[model samples]
Target: MTRIFNFSPGPAALPEPVLKQAQQELLNFRGLGVSVMEISHRGKEFMDVAEQAEADFRDLLQLPDNYHVFFMQGGASLQFSMVPLNLLGEKSTADYLNTGNWSTAAIKEARRLCDVNVVASSEDTNFDRIPALDTWKLSKDAAYLHITGNETIGGVEFHEYPDLGTTPLVSDMSSTLLSRPLDVEKFGVIYAGAQKNLGPAGMTIVVVRDDLVGLARANTPRLLDYQVYADSGSMANTPPTFAWYLCGLVFKWIKSLGGLTAMAEINSRKAKKLYAAIDESNYFTCPVAEADRSWMNIPFTLADAGRDGEFLELAKARGLLNLKGHRSVGGMRASIYNAVPEAAVDALIEFLREFEKREA
Candidate 1:
């Protein structure tokens, strides 16, 4: 059996051990005599998986008792709207930081529901760096201060979170969740699409402070209400049973690797190696600033844009697949998510050198 190094941003690579375990139990699912995909979400088999997933997740994040973890279906995009729908309370505006594509999208969705205050932005620089927190002009009575923990398309991340005295802080952590240790108490709410560092695309993980619940607007859909999901234990509907189960396995896999602290060290080392290769080479350039570069996604461009297609083709043939950057930005992007191994990064670096030599 052969598996190539996969670098696609979403639906990214998963821990190999977890994949192997799933393959071994795909049909039987630990003596249940049925695939997890075919079982009832309310049954003991799947319920146990759901409960364990929440517990392991809570352990990994050290979540406070005031926070409630909801395993919902809509991806992070849905939370963009739900954040305003549920948390807006009586405020007419929300503060948002426009960093890159994802942040911009979040802001766009939010604008539809309430008056949006773009507190600060790095769009002027094409999102090569995160805007300084001190420069943010937060509204006096805003609903919440929103930020994207990491921008996947632009390869920029915020290493330090901002402190919003009395206001609640909300973040879209889709691409960077679980990549490092986060202060669960710092943000009032945190949401992530499971595709990046978790299990798959169908699941969305939301950690909302208990106080933030029970405030949805009257017109909010029942499924979009945070309180409903929280009260129902994230089982308001059938839920994504198979995706939830897989995510539980991933949480266990992460625990086995010594939790986020260990994962953070590995991710930092991997990003350093890849960034070093880009910085030391004259043939490639990373647009994002050094301080703001993302540990998971590193987007770089060849000195000659004409060679982008050629580089991608050769890299794929050599077993490095899905290295293409997002269409909005034309270049090469290597998304080294939590499951991507260091050896794969080394292989990519080796290919970079070979390609540079051949093309130069």
Candidate 2:
């Protein structure tokens, strides 16, 4: 079977090795008679798988002892509600950076739970850039400061994280997590939906500092409470076993390739190549600012809107799939997550060149 290069934003692509390994083990996981999906989450076999996945992830991040990792259900959208429901102890407001679609969604959810103070926003710029750090109107007493590490749809990212003294820094790193090494100690909370850089669509990986737990308001649902996951090791409910197992395989794959440091080097090279191609070509244009461009997601527009359909159809014919941009922002987007290899980027760059030549 042949695999085409995929660029969908979420439920993106999985490493071929990981997929093959899962396929081999699907019928009878590691000599067990039943599929991992049918096994009990609390059973020793699945428990071991869950524990090792967290351990490898911690090793990848060099996570500190003070932080607890939980594999929860859904994507980071659940964390949008959980973050404010839990972190906003007695504070009336939380600070948020409005970068793009995910950031706006998080801010809207927080507003329902507490007063949301937008620290900075790039709305006036049509979300083409990150609001300069100096322009942020921060609150010293805010519960926590929130930022989307990367904007999947808009293709903007915070290349450098903000330094907030005393206040906890929170991030929705769904699109950027595990793409490179991160300073785990710099933030009180980090949550990632397990589709882009992780394994699958059904699980989310949440890393929260010890202090951030046990503070959910009395009215918060038990399942929505971070404390419950922490207390029960994310087995308070039946977890997504297959997704968790696949995530473990992915973590191992990353480790086998020499961990996040190596992964970062490869990802940087891939993104640099693609961005350089976009910048050098008059036939294409990247809408985001140079400094704020995302290494994981690259959105570019053809010279005109009329060529979009031809561009997409030709791309598909040439084995490049899902290059269509989000409907909100019309154009083309390429989500080069961890599973996407440098060769894919090279292929994309070559396609862009040929397509532009044909248009010219």
Candidate 3:
């Protein structure tokens, strides 16, 4: 069997040990004699799983007592609407940072519910760089400032947190969550879809400050209301049991490997190696600014655009799967998430060298 290193952006690679553990318990989870997928989410066993998962995540993030972690069903996309629906209240305006496609989508959703002020934007620069924080035009009466911590499609990231003074800060951290350490106290809410560095596609993890829980609009649906989920422990409805279980394994795996600090060191080393390759080669170039480059997703282009398909084909033959970029971008993206081993990055570098030599 060919050993393939998957680099897909989401629904991406997961730790091998976690996968093996799931395989071992797939049909008979913890002597229950049924797949976790077949079990009731409200069952005591499942509740324990959910509780421990949340506890581990809180511990991993060093979450303060004021923060509440909720594992919900909707992807982070749903949070775009939920954020405004819950936090906007009587305020007619909110601030947004337009970093890339995801942030743009978030802004569009917020516009439907409130007067959105695009405080900072990189669209004029083709999403190649993060807008400088000093240039943002935050409104004095804005309800909250929303920013996408990492843009998956553009391969751009705000490595540092945005400052919005008294206005609450909300971030869509779908691609960057769990990839590194974060100061949980810096933001009012941080939400992530669970396919990148977490677990599967069905779960979204939200960490919201306790004080912000009861701010939902009067007509907000119970499911979309943060306060309801916070009050009920994210069990107001049936949750994605299997996905939650998988996330627990992932969190445990992260802990075994020394938590986010160690993970950040490894992720940084991986991105640096791949970016160094791209920057050094005349045949390849990365468009993002060095300061704003995403450690999880690195988008680069070939010097000769005509050879893009050829490069992808050769990369696939060598077991470097999913090296293609997002459809909107039309280039290559190597998403070196936590599960991607350093050896895989080294292998990719070797392939890049061989391919370039052949082209020359």
Candidate 4:
């Protein structure tokens, strides 16, 4: 009956309307006698749900006809290996931008399969800012250029995507997908874990260009092969039925709110307000650079690290939950994903002001 502004990043908060609709339909989905979770994924009813979800997703991103969308089971972490296993055809190198933790993980996975070329990295600065694109030393024949659209842990984001002329540009957009409008044609592949913006933790969405399919290595597992999933319509195995259905409902909810353009406006407004509060207050500090700060995840630090526990405790007492930052980078993180309303951000900002007064 009661819900706090839940913001624990992945498996993050979903829109309340979507949750309510799911609750209403949980027992019997749209007049069916069985729950959506109990239905057959291959059945016509589930098939229709899958098809419509893909369609709405394509509409949201305005994807071109050449792209094929696959609803896969692996999380975005799996794509770190899948990208290299499938895309690094013949070429021994792939260009990666080491912007933060996620990108570093992707690079490490790629290294196991191919020679990774880290073209640009912000690690020298402790991942506080994105390396300038012009400073990159790209390989002439790298298989694909990899980038993380948003670094959830470090709270850094790439405002503009790199222009990799001939090479395929692949991105791990796990944290920022569907938060705003994107040019689908700009990249050869885009993969996102569903938990952040899509739906639940069990599903991953992959959008790959037609030209990029059918190139998996000879030893690649059938399930791990992009072409295999493409051929079977992402039913290479029994997909996560419940997660897929919830994602479909989420897609529908997003469309009802006027699609990505409107969603972007809302996200931008919320981020700007939250960032302004952090900037104006000496009590809190956002380490990420202004130009590179993530609109989805905002990690900040209290003036005194010793007071971090108190801040989280008081914030939770006041109805703000999951404000703890990642373990690797200790502090506080406010993951304001699509489901997070503007009022939640306003409430958090007000809480920050009050907490500061009490602690000071």
TM-score of each: 0.99, 0.99, 0.98, 0.99
Runs in model 2 deviating more than 4 A are: none
lDDT, candidates in the order shown: 0.93, 0.93, 0.91, 0.92
Q: For candidate 4, lDDT tens digit of each residue in 1-360?
A: 678987788789999999999999999988998899898899999999999889999999999999999999879989999999998888789999999999999999888989999998999899999898889989999999999999999999988886778899999999999999998888999999999999999999999999899888889999999999889999989999899989999999999999999999999999999999999998999999999999999999998999998888888898899999999999999999999999899999999899888877
For candidate 3, list the clashing residue pairs, or say none. Answer: none
What is the C-alpha lDDT profile of model 3 across 152-271, one tens digit per residue? 999998788855567899999999999999988889999999999999889999988888888887777889999999878898988888999999999999999999999999999999
Per-residue C-alpha lDDT of model 2 across residues 85-168, encoded as one tens digit per residue: 899988899999999999999999988988889989999999999999999999878999999999999999877887888899
Worst 10 residues of 4 by lDDT: 1-10
Per-residue lDDT value at 116 in model 2: 89
| lDDT at 190, model 2 | 96
lDDT of 4: 0.92
Cα lDDT of model 2 overall? Answer: 0.93
In candidate 2, position 85 carries an lDDT of 88
Worst 10 residues of 3 by lDDT: 158-167
Error of 1 at 73 (Å): 0.8
